[model samples]
Target: MACSVATHNTKSNPPVTTTGSDSDSGINGNTNNTNRLNELKFDVFESITNFAGNFDLDPDQNFYKNCTNLSNYFLCDQFACKFKTVDTQKSFSSIHFNARSLVKNLDAIMEFIETLHFQFDIIGISETWCNENSPPLNIPNYTLLSKNRNGRVGGGVALYVSNLRSYTQRNDISLTNISCDSIFIEINQNHGKNIIVGVAYKPPDVNSNHFVDDFDKILTTIDKENKLNYIMGDFNLDLLRYTSINSTQDFLNILYSNFYLPLINRPTRITSNTATLIDNIITNSHDLPVTSGILYCDISDHLPIFQITSFINDSFQNDVPIQSYRLINPLNIENFKQDLATNGWDDAQMS
Candidate 1:
């Protein structure tokens, strides 16, 4: 199904690659970067009931350190592995931008990310130029989970989910309820609770009331399951001019009544004649612990919006009191045994 694909991390699996050229790998003078990325391979596994992912760095010292730095976006050890300690809350960064056209700006976006001096796990993009016909974009260490406009052009949404955590798209939630594009997914936090992430793009001409009603349905459906919701994207609504009885009041009312906190208070899109706060990030749960603002990057007309949220450890660490296991079925048992037996056992022990 086009809805989803899952794979277990196994030695037999081949490396995954994108179709087009690797001309803009963000790393300079590294023509071999794509091959190196392919070498740092892993996979995701899912059963009928649950989903999980695991990957180990290759032991080559230089390759391992280079891949780790590139994969984690140059984050310090404290930021990337914050979950290693129990009872310690670590902040996770998420970014959102109205790309105007994603294809043309992909390289700039990657370059911009590399300069951030820290790591962020999720990015929501609106007006991605990709339709059903566009080829896949191969961003190393990140997965592009997207929803293209089915019938029209110019409007679409995507989530650039980092490979650092486990995530599954919510195919059950339909985006056709409203006249826009969106991608919804459930992020498995490794604990019993999952975080619901919704990235949406609402056309400027769509009626605010209808949009509010449809959006309410989406939230109510997710809320019924008692999941925390973080919705971010470009709605094209001028929230700065909001009032108790304005044209966009119903949408604001729904958000306010649902306890959804709007994180960006400044203008996101600025033209020569106008400045509007159309892009935003909102959430209903305080337990997620988020702080946010607008970034002054010049990648697009819409300034990038960002949020930092605290999450417990959600990686492949087995000692976190979560159940995780892997079954080994070596293809060549005799060779494996002989290889193990041939090691310098006495010398290693004496050392």
Candidate 2:
């Protein structure tokens, strides 16, 4: 719903694995903060956001003073990152990337995060060949979630968080399709939303529509449970334009069926290789207000994605602008099937 397409290809050697359920304080589930979740969400009812965070008593006389608050803090420490007009002096903060990748310098992942200097709540990444037990680790104030492909080289994901405590991280290990989708759930003190985040990657050879079905199923499961969801990932297909197999209609089916909307301010180039926009950040749009639909470029082959929406300020309203987003979509697959059947796998059959 956020990023569409670009031209880039990043590679890593050997497969890697990241495992374990997350357990962070302040944001973990079962902490008994249910009463405050909606308090932090946006409200057209109020002009000022109801976000809850650590409001600095005496914010530094720098640009960052506008960024930080009493209830929450920066997720990254980067400057180039576009913020919600909060702090100015000290740059925005974001979570770091996984330490391991199939290619790039082994430390390229961490090095990139450190250099950017931004605070992030969630990061949807690709090009990681993660194996079991060796998941990217030791990151401060965050948790990880992802699905790693078995026979692939560079395909995996990680979802990190700050302020909110993470509950569990699960991988969508599927063989029929070439997608490593890692999903996680976290309990936030503010807003009291049960965030469902997934890090997904679909290679060109994979059935993009099948991946889309898997993605919609996740949202459906989350919605059935009545959990407010926010999903991020690398959905190899482009949403703006449509592929006969994976077109705009395909994407709309999933989102519209689930009554969801695209998160604002997605990435133009999520892949690190070329300038292709394949990353995204999508949410139940009706729940948000004043969100960013797109964002700027960065040092990596793929650009970073973000979102910023207004929610009600329950007991805890982090007002965490989903600033960075990872493009991830599709639907109406029946048409694709009929089209493929009526025609052939290739275009010649149609005539």
Candidate 3:
């Protein structure tokens, strides 16, 4: 199955090189003075280059004192003083991994998270293998929302959202309702529309047609919400064989018809014998700038996939007061009258 790909164009500019020459006849007449001037120019250039390379320079150094004079030079542009402005855009990052059994690899997973350069807004885990008897698991500064399979041992899905973000779980379309291991949450934005994020896990043993039908229903429910949607998981259906497998083709058709594009094209799970593209992150937010890829890690058989979406901040005036009023209905009016009549007005008047 052919899919549309987005391309980006980057413009590159050549670096500027500077050279010093003694053009004055007076200076040229004196070779020693000309050589001295050339040496000085070389020293200055080297000093600037060294300063740019080293960030641990002393605050009281002569280089710091001369920064103002050097600001006129192109090489010193980075040292110029400027006011820092808050960015008007924010990014939402998410990562999904099939841990196989989260209980066994919790320590390794935490260590892996600590190694990340940036914090992820959402952490999705499939095949958690959690049951009612499973121990409570926690990650610092994150709220856990999980749906564990009851009366079973293997299938479960979990979502961990940063405490800083405001969100609400969507129980209406819970994965349990569709007989799948998944969880859905709506991320609340201060000004713009909210974003819906879901993580699902489809067992390989299940009937593909039933899975497709159930997944289609979930997509339909999400489409009706009309919000930016990101659905990720290990569906266990190799997308590389979309053309050959009817179920895989049907799955892609459902996603494409709903405007959700799968971002991961390369194989996510690889072994000595075979490689398959079963893990994926699909989203309907085509307009938003997104970067996605798989992270090479040894935590599990399947690699981790991540997506970073940049959303333009929609600023709103906080000073504007929201209008509010109380409703005056017959029931409220009667309740008010009954309360008034029930009060000891005669006793108060006599007092």
Candidate 4:
């Protein structure tokens, strides 16, 4: 409830004002800002994000010219949609972040979805209250990976991938296991590539990092036997602005010690700061040189950061994958659903 926000002390930036225009926009004041806006807008808004991400190995020389850069963020009126009205939209891909509510309007949701269909390679969703038993959704090139907390709402995350069968990893756990756990997964690159793509949401709590530590443990388990990793999610803690309780900087110390590096560079832009950065992309410190870093975005309610990490593959690491259950029979599914219908879940309850 009461959180201290952080501030941006960066001075290199020029003043920016989003010009109100009908079919087009004009910013005759600062061409430099316009160039930066143009550069950031194209790749950042193109829904089908396809950045190579951070691979610790020095890319095959001349990679800079070929390396992909994808940074897109969304805030749908309700659930997001792909739009067709914008005659000139990127075709590479599209991604939509929807916050559908029980009390929200329906048309606005459709419009947003129309806008979203414009482009997207992968899509991450939150606040979707649907469970495993619900009828399948009819979305093209889109396969859903959801963890529904309950039928009412709260604490859920999912990924919609195209050609999902080619990418492997399909989770068919029931509503009970899904509700009881947070949704976090590593979507590695094609052909056993080592990049681990992830998404997460933090509940409103001060002891959030401890929960993050649990998430980290899961990462540890996954990467325990496999190396090379990259993760992005709503971390909910801005180390620059937040400090934990119980006698000292245990959380920050642990986070940094684990080689966690937020996607932001030094003197990041202010996006409603409250002590620490609540939304972040974390990777090993080696991914960045501290001097050169990723671009920080302020388009959504949360600031999103994108890193152009150096190339260098990590040493092979082994991690024992966490024991995850698979749906066996009709009885197991019904029995698990019954258990969830009663106890449900609490945000405070972390594994």
Give TM-scores for every candidate, taking all chains together and pairing residue i with residue i.
Answer: 0.62, 0.53, 0.64, 0.46
How well is each residue in 1-351 modelled by candidate 1, as lDDT tens digits? 121111123343223232222232232212232233223321101110111112121112211121111111112222324323323224556788788788888888887766654556788899897877777765678888988876777888889888886888998875565468888888877554577888998887777677778877777788777666788999876665554326555666566555465666655565433455578887764444455655545677777777776654343122233232333346445555766787779987988
Candidate whose TM-score is highest: 3
Best by lDDT: 3
lDDT of each: 0.60, 0.42, 0.65, 0.38
TM-score sort, best first: 3, 1, 2, 4
Alpha-carbon runs more than 4 Å astray in model 3: 1-89, 176-179, 313-351
Instruction: Encode model 3's per-residue lDDT on 42-104: one tens digit a residue.
Output: 122233333333222322233223121110110011111110121224777788889888889
lDDT of 2 at 266: 22
lDDT of 2 by residue, 205-262 (tens): 6666676777777776677755556666566555433323344456655765575644
Q: Give the CA lDDT, 0 to 100, for residue 234 in model 2.
A: 61
Give model 3's TM-score versus the native structure: 0.64
Count: clashes, candidate 2 = 124
lDDT score for candidate 3 against the true structure? 0.65
Model 1, which residues run further than 4 Å from truth? 1-89, 312-351
Assess the local accuracy of residue 295 in candidate 3 as a C-alpha lDDT between 0 and 100: 58
Which has the higher TM-score value, candidate number 1 or candidate number 3? 3
Q: What order do candidates take by lDDT, descending?
A: 3, 1, 2, 4
